[model samples]
Target: MKMNHGFSWQYDEFKQVGTDYGSKAEVEIYDSSHADFRDMEAESIRILDSLEIKRSNVLIDFGSGTGTFAIQAARRCARVYAVDVSRAMIDRAEAKAIKAGTSNIEFHHAGFLTYEHNDSPVDAVVTTFAFHHLPDFWKGIALKRVNSMLKPGGQLYIHDVILEETNAVENIAALIDKLATAGGKLLREDTERHFRDEYSTYDWVMDGLLSRSGFTIKSKHIEGGVLGTYICTKN
Candidate 1:
């Protein structure tokens, strides 16, 4: 699918829907259906081990969907910044944080790519399943922003879909599984619509982002082998 620079979804609309997707969507996608997106797909095991949270370290979950990850990070991380573009998402994240009884978390309802933060003291910038939404040109720009947010020598532990470099068929079961889950209906439709709308040229549910972006590709933790965690080091 070819991505159009101006063919981005209405930011507000997309985010509002995304915010409502709490643990239910995340857990279901990973557990019962879409085996590729299974909880293991988030690369939690690898992320947990690769994470270097400490007494004084600070971490940020860029585009934190519903705070599930933020809550988990707060347990071990001294502090965590959960930033998302949707106000709804931020509210849910904050609510989740409160429910989880985590005090070290700071929630921001702003686009991480454009949000301003002067204190770039974080040890690592953890971005999971967010970068792919960026407009064509901004993918690189977004990476630079995340890179800048990291302290010198900090790490970037990202876990997102690693699109195949070649054109291969998608699993039909993944499509069927989406129809059975809580938010699967919309997720499945939108996901397919997105691929259909965008994958005509330079991309189309293809994998090339992480590989094309030079960040010193480090370790990748795999689940179904198609989905995995990528841990990178900053120069």
Candidate 2:
């Protein structure tokens, strides 16, 4: 699909905010920082298992940071597209994939609103902690684009920080405190930056966005009243 250049309200996702993942230093520290809260390798395995990935399947991973999921998925799927907005991230992921001897993965320096999937419709698309980079409207547009990239009944898995409406203030505070305890000052500061600068939205809004984007929400799981995982199928 051609990019819209005319007058529109779409947000430019490439604009850096608090943390610039494009920086080599940031990319280098990403895995270590996230390791405080995430077991990325195990997470990749779980996502692949959830999707029931096969040797013949083609998968696309949006914002595939440091090649964790993309490299792992490449082992099981026929081809894997690792798309991210950061050139540094793409470079790092590519290096990691090479070190692992996984060559079926193609790396793209692109974002959700900009990446074009020109290949055949994929079997599944996965994005973790990345979709929130876009505003709600752009997220809908991105989801529509994702829907167009999938085969019939294809799956889209999104894991991100989505807020719950009930006691939002309390929940967010508790989550911040918990993260601080688990990951120390850096994570606490990161979480604060996310809330202060990022665009994570509410569950109700996300539900509507997914439905309007021609997706059937198969399951929704929210952990610690903040982290949301939505398993959806293209309608």
> Top lDDT: which candidate number?
2
Q: lDDT tens string, model 1, 1-235?
A: 1122364552332343322343445433432443433463254435655776676778888878767777877787688888877565677668767888899898876664556665656788887766555655556556666766777677888665444334323532354355446455655765665445432213222224544443555666543323446677666
Q: How accurate is candidate 1 locally (lDDT)?
A: 0.59
Q: Candidate 1 at 147: error in angstroms?
A: 0.9
Residue 70 CA displacement from its true place in model 1, Å = 0.6
The residue-level lDDT of candidate 2 at 55 comes to 97
Collision count for each candidate, in order:
13, 0
- Error (Å) of candidate 1 at residue 210 is 6.1
The per-prediction CA RMSD against the true structure, in angstroms, equals: 6.4, 1.2
State each model's CA lDDT, in order.
0.59, 0.91
| Residue 199 lDDT, candidate 1, scale 0-100 | 20
